[model samples]
Target: MPITLTIPDGLLSPTAQAEAFAALTEAVLEVSGLNGNAFMTSNVVGSINVLPREHVLVAGKPAQAAFVELKLPEIALATPEAKRTFIEKATDVVERAAGGRLQRDHIWSNIVYAPDGAWGIAGRSYDNGDLISAITGSAA
Candidate 1:
């Protein structure tokens, strides 16, 4: 899975930005019941894009904002409750990182699911079964 955290420059201090990204990662793993899973931990990768303030927009106008997007296989965060929990936790991570510089409403989050057999790693495509086996360290 990959989590992309896009934010306006200066929305968070450098240290806070790093911490928030780590926190967001932890939130997703924990909510998905994969916390402490070495395979999942290593696979949970992401990027933090800090763009110019003018590039970040809301209502078509430049604004202070953050976007957290998680791209994963359909098998992850499959439950409604898990989705809700992640959204909530992700929002909190950004809010806390802002240190009163940003608002919850200004932070947005979304999850995009890759179709079965489409998710890939190391140049090889992985279906849902392949992912499960890899995550569990067992044969599919």
Candidate 2:
């Protein structure tokens, strides 16, 4: 899984940006119940893009906004409840990190599931079963 975070450069202090990234990672793993799974933990990766104010847009107008997008295989956050939990928690993590600098309404989050076998890491593609086996350290 990869969690991408995009925020206006000034929206968060350097310390907050680092805090948010770490919190966001934990939220994803915790919500998906993969917190301690080696494969899942190692694969949970992404970039934090701190764009210029003018480059950040909301409703076609430049604004202070943040977006957290998660791309993962089907089995990750597989349930509606799980996805909802992640959205709520992820948004909270970002907002809190901003130290009230960002409006809750300005934060957006979404989980996008890849088709089975379409997710990859280190040049190896993984399907639902492949992930399960790796996470559990067992043959499927």
Candidate 3:
């Protein structure tokens, strides 16, 4: 899984940005019930893109916004409740990180599911079964 956190420059302080990224990663693992899992923790990687303010937009106009995007296999966060929890928790992380400098509505979150066999790591393709087995340390 990868969590991409995109924000307009200056929306969050340097320290806050780093904290937000860490929190976002934790939110995913925590909600997915994978916290402390070595493989998942190490593989839950992504970037924090602090783009120019003008580059971020809302309805064709520039806006101070934050975007949280999670890319994972379909089998992850498989339940509706899990998805909901992640979204809510992610938005909360961004909001708290902003220290009231940004609006709640401006912080958006979404999840994109990779098709089976399309997810890969370490140059090896991993299907749903492979991922499940790797995560659980047992046959899927």
Comparing candidate 2 with candidate 3, which one achieves the higher lDDT? 3
State which candidate, 1 or 3, has the greater lDDT. 3
| Over 4 Å off, model 3 | 138-140
Q: Tens-digit lDDT track for model 1 on 1-140?
A: 89999999988889998999999989988998888887788889999999999999999999999999999899999899999999999999999999998878999999999999999788999999988888888321
Worst 10 residues of 2 by lDDT: 131-140
Show model 2 residue runs off by greater than 4 Å.
Answer: 138-140
Where is model 1 more than 4 Å wrong at Cα? 138-140
Residue 69 alpha-carbon offset, candidate 1, angstroms: 0.2
Report the lDDT tens digits of candidate 3 across residue range 70-117: 999999998999999999999999999999989999999999999999
Q: What is every candidate's alpha-carbon RMSD to the true fold?
A: 1.7, 1.8, 1.8
Q: Give the alpha-carbon lDDT of every model.
A: 0.92, 0.88, 0.92
Ranking by lDDT: 3, 1, 2
> What digit string (tens of lDDT, one per residue) describes model 2 on residues 11-60?
98888888999999999889877777777788888999999899999999
TM-score per candidate, in order? 0.96, 0.95, 0.96
